[model samples]
Target: MSAVNDTSFNSAVFLLTGIPGKEDVHLWISIPFFLIYVISIVGNSVIILIIKTDPSLHVPMYIFLSMLAVTDIGLSMSTMPSTLGIFLFNYKEISLDACFAQLFFVHLFSFSESSVLLLMSFDRFIAICNPLRYASILTLPRIAKMGLVCALRSVALVFPLPFLLKRFPYCHTNVLSHSYCLYQEVMKQACSDITVNSIYGFAVKLLAVGLDSLLIFLSYVMILTTVLSVTSSTESIKALNTCVSHVCAILFYYLPDIGLSVIHRFGNSSSNLPQVVMGYIYLLIPPLMNPVVYSMKNKHLRSRLFKAFCK
Candidate 1:
């Protein structure tokens, strides 16, 4: 494995679905993605507005919610334009630089979203376990700090991807599988082997993804124990229902991502469709489903949102 550290190496070219320069998947891809994008934006925007407009929602939970809406918008903005642009112009040629840019931003927003979720878990923990201290624990400054930390963490961890990719000379082969430059696919064309890249990627997942998830798990565990100690079945049921949407969102979003990662790593090519389905499920589903999940369950916020829409 020779090290091809050519900083100026050009990215290789690849065709979509084996058709050289054909945008045949444009309409089929664009229509669905566009619809989903609109839904995501609107749903998230409404949630944000409701949270902001309603004084009743000015709590830690809703602040985290507003952060989620912002993150969802950023998430959509990061990925949707290039995707929609590719389809609209029927132009499928993505340069190496552009591909790396997309990958970095995608991961950046993804990391932010995960961090926000972790903060939310802590929010719920404080509300449930130490209700008396909830306000002091999650003050405006604390919340602001959490958001800042997430933003900084995202930029810090994700900013390194493009730089690492730079270490490899893209001798050729820019054929990206799927609409974007999926990491494994681009890394596959490394003129120099990216064993370290694979390691870094795994380490990122372990630290950022794994540790964030572990904290969420612990927060929930404490919440569950506290709820159990209530001894009132009615209170337990009510608390359970209150967290239903968030719990479902967590399970649905992470379950598909975990599934896709396993299949992509271990399964053969015959699993491409499932992998593809899971890809959309991983990216689009959370943003799409999140607002709906919260709206359907969160009566106070949802009622305000509906009232705003009605007016």
Candidate 2:
């Protein structure tokens, strides 16, 4: 352990960690990560393009899907640089400012994604429960306003994090546990009292991700109730089926996220390997899987994709 008073805030450099005990195979490991990045970028881009170019798909649901695709791209890009740098080029050292910037964007996209998912659930709820007024209630201008509010909320919540973390003096080992800079991971390295940081981080997670998750759950509960009230079982099945893609999106996004949180809170240093692996899964899988899920489940998207590629 270094002396607490020895390190200055401006001079701090954090070493981003790749997979533990896999140093000899980093080049090999980079192969799959590179593939994941390529697929994620290409897949999400295709989804966004399909939604944007098709006037028929400009409804609130597809528009929210586009927002999700954009956010997934942002999330993937945030970690890709440092991750590939470390594995392919042995570039592990990240300056404090660079790390903070990366952390901010990562969280921004993450929270934004959460907000988009919540909005998507609302879209579904309205479409299923009140199909008559869905159009009037979810006008294009109103959807745009909802998106702007979500973005602004995410920015306002995450904007203070870098500055807050910057105020703390770090004398502990500056090696980050994952290939990217995360708020909790960075705060752990600070030698000073991180009470405020901890509180703020917890609050942000609670208010942003936590609240989003809770509302999403409630939305689905109401959806299910409404779904069950349908006198025709076939209609009920059809209505629920429409949500299949979104449900998969939610599972992919939140399951690993919850697993990572559990591991971080309960696991010790021995859990580093799982932590890193889960971190990669949490970040990479959703972007890569979302397009495939949506295209396969959504008839409109699937048809559009087939027409574009088959032609």
Candidate 3:
């Protein structure tokens, strides 16, 4: 096997694959994926429009929601096209530059979503724990700043990944595990020692997604403790109710994520279906479900959504 470690590697391309052993079902598979892409795009778009158009939703909670919707849209768009192309049209050839671009945006939105969730957790924490200070604490400017920080942080961390991958010699098979590119998946195809790439990847994931998840969990624990201490049972339920949608959103995002991580790290490569299915779930479910959960849980938003559609 000849090692391609020169400048020519800058133009090297990779063939993205559908589920490894399930090519025959690619056409049928495309249907559900297309539907999911449509739903995720439409659902998040509606959430953004509703929030922007409604004066009643000009609060911190809704502002945080809008940020989440935007991130969801970004996430859906980053990977959906290539994913569908691979499954439906068998367009498997992806240029190295294009693959890197996809990797950056996919990871950018992923970490952005994690950051937004952390922000949402803080929003809930303030609303539940210190209602009197909620308005004063999370003003529109502050929320905007938080969103900017999340975006910048995600970009800064994920930006280094493609460059790092570019430096490695790709003498092995250039076929990726999924229809989309990922840091570890791409790294695994390298021929040389990837000690630096491995460590950096671990540190990035730990610092970004892992730390954010830990903080969100702690925020919820504090929120729960505070809610349970409330004197009235009705009040406790009401407080907890405010967090239910966020809790569901968190679970929807992280559970599939953890499952995919486990499968990638520990599962057998011979069985590709589980990993592919879970990858689709991880990528598609949150964006599709977030607006639905939020609309159903928040009466004000739901009523406004209904009135807007009825018009």
Highest TM-score scorer: 2
Q: What TM-score does structure 3 among the candidates reach?
A: 0.96
Off by over 4 Å in 3: 1-8
Q: What digit string (tens of lDDT, one per residue) describes model 3 on residues 1-311?
A: 13354655656778887877778998998998899889889988988998998888899889889989998999999999899999889999888778888989988998899999999999999999999999999998888998898889998999999999887767566888788988888888887899999899989989898999999999999998998888899999988999999999999999998898889889998777888779888888999999999999999999998998999
Best by lDDT: 2
* RMSD of each predicted structure: 3.3, 2.0, 1.8
**C-alpha-based local distance difference test score of model 1:** 0.76
Clashing pairs in 2: none
Query: How would you encode candidate 1's per-residue C-alpha lDDT over 18-132 as one tens digit per residue?
Result: 1224456667767888999999999999888778877888888899988887888877877776667677765667677778888887777777888888888888888788889
What Cα-based lDDT does every candidate model obtain? 0.76, 0.93, 0.89
List of clashing residue pairs for candidate 1 = 12-173, 12-174, 13-174
* Cand. 2 Cα-lDDT: 0.93
Q: How many backbone clashes does candidate 2 have?
A: 0
Better of 1 and 2 by TM-score: 2
